[model samples]
Target chain A: MYLVADINVEICAAKSCKLCTQYCPEANTILYSDEMGKDQGFKYGSAYVAVDRCKGCAQCVWVCDNMAKNNAIKMIMIDQLPKAALTDNITYGEKSTTAVLASPVVG
Target chain B: MSLDYVKFSNGFEKFMPKEYRDMVEHGPFGKKVSVSQVGSFKEVLEEHPMCAGCAMTLFIRLAMVAFPNPEDTITVGTAGCGRLAISQAAIPFVYGNYGDQNGVASGLSRGLRLRFGDKPKDVVVMAGDGGTADIGFQQVLHSWFRKERFTTIMLDNEVYGNTGGQESGMTNRGAVLKMAPLGKKFEKMDMVQMAKVAGCAYVATVVPNNPRRVESVIKKAVLIAREVGSTYIQAYTSCNIEYAIPTDKVMEDAKAVENDRYQFTEYVSEEAKQYLTERYGYKEFLAKPAAAIPNKA
Candidate 1:
């Protein structure tokens, strides 16, 4: 699986548009979170990847780079992620998670 | 060979992926040539920092492959996204200030002529639409006016992509950009006509999708520029980021021009033609299926 390790919040339009999430083939691989919105001083939200289940397909990255025309998402090699990679963010569904997370949404 | 190895490979197959194999088998510009006859000895450039699937990368690669001699060739780049990506080019490159590429090429041409004398040395200027049509327009005109013996190529992506999609003189009239929120006010500059008026020996507009035409034209341009005078080749490149499209759609967008609005133009001076015929035995220099390249605005 690939990791969306760095989301350049500044480059992202940050309109909480869920194109990336909607385009992902895997379920729950990308989850919309309000934390990124807080970081960008927006009340809406932004998309976060569940790196473990990402599968590195880069569909989300393609969506962000092409459809959205925002270079926010970067599909990084899993081996390149730091040891504390998934420890810094609150992932979706989980009551408590940090940094990054991913899952495929069925339906 | 072992039976297992025989099953895995064909004698001619290089065992590379289909795309790499195609590039190798069909030659760099999609033509068949022996390994020894390939234009450049080695791929001078292997990597770039341009946006993934940038059209400029394709044009640059084709230019490198079309060059007859890489050892004696020097590329000068001016500011813009094209220049940004050329930083890692395998060939030697000089980073000229925006619009100063022609001036740099002029000086280089003179110096190379003085040093090499009879030996051929190519000095190619790689610049963007903004550098050619706007920022560096005057210097380019002056260089052409002086008939500098060098080839100047403009990778015209329409918009000033590197500067956050600003409107450039080459940008389409109705195209909206950060600087032209409502669309650009003026029509795009007719650089071909301008070049003709400026006394350029050869001028051609090409699209990167047509590798054969690109290779033929650039090689001809380099030769004509050396034997005759200045040559200008403006390649219609698409800016996926600025155009807000998928990177893979750049070629589609570039090809769509043939159907409507945009048309290609190629012009060669009599002097250049005579030089080609005399030096290279090119009987017909003007006839290259002109329909494939539109001549009108």
Candidate 2:
């Protein structure tokens, strides 16, 4: 499990209030990307989660939902994700995807 | 070991978790950082399982930032909501039995003092209202009366938040809750005044509405307790869940409560005042009106 940032509704107040980035226990798991916000046409930068580094603590989700009141981040179960959905704008999922694909489920 | 132990080596850096690496490199462990730099730097607190919009969690975060020497400081807490976030911090923490934080801290501070021998290992006792005022009242008072060289901080959320919204001694009079359905018959214990009378060199009552003020008061208390007698800080960290306060209105409620009764107040003994003024040049604390003088025969 990992976290994904919804750039549309998660209009992050990146520099002004980076609560998720500051409070996340793991380092470099959450980063403020000016380019990501610019690509999404947001006036301010937004935060993105590094899927490979994220421990799925859901701390960022709590901070975003309660403290920031933005409700922009959500936890995604890697097994439930469709194969094609991995190529979407949820950046930094390639590593997790390859690892998951390398080990096929033997039910 | 020296502070170098907290830093990572060049060759084995990759083997270390990025959390520890960031804490060593960008955290406020040994460096001088303020609350304003919170977002720009790495915080000592990690992801906690406390309730959403928990005021106690927020205060714990600020207290971590206020530690003058995080690398050398050891926090002691009891069974309460405050410990959930406190134990998550990167610093070493001792979670004592119910309401035994003051007892544990007395021994821990003395042991650290003997081991370090003026190296400055700050031992802080952080507990909830029930832990400090009700369950551990005797230990807390004796620790102050004995002049144990440690700082005691009470996270006053008014009620027993962790035990399902029961009433505590720190709960305000007439505040209805589970155990006190008819409302508390007595007024809240005046811990600040108690601390002053019990021989605490410094005492302060604060709320978490202003992060900077919280940091400053905590830093001062910890620093004073290092050399002076014991110090105390009672922070009003409201329990939004038990109190039925809306998450968004948490800060507003704190502000209202502070204005109504728990206004920010600080009391420093003459010795601590002289020490602070001489060492840190904090003369402004002395400018405040002194406590009323007692009658002498």
Clashing pairs in 2: none
Best by DockQ: 2
Error of 2 at A36 (Å): 8.8
Model 2 chain B: ten consecutive residues of lowest lDDT:
B34-43
10 residues in a row with least lDDT, candidate 2 chain A: A94-103
Model 1 per-residue lDDT tens digits across residues B104-138: 88999999899878788889998999998899999
TM-score of each: 0.63, 0.75
Please state the i-RMS of candidate 1. Answer: 18.5
Over the stretch B173-281, how does candidate 2's per-residue lDDT look in tens digits? 9999876799998999989888989999989999887677898899889989999989999999999878998655667677889999989999888888888888888
Best TM-score among the predictions, by candidate number: 2
Q: How does residue A61 of candidate 1 score in lDDT? A: 65
* Share of native C-alpha contacts between chains A and B (below 8 angstroms) recovered by candidate 1: 0.00
Residues A1-107, candidate 1: write the lDDT tens digits.
43443455545435555655444433333545555566567655555655544444454565567667777887565655443223123322222112443322212
DockQ of each: 0.02, 0.08
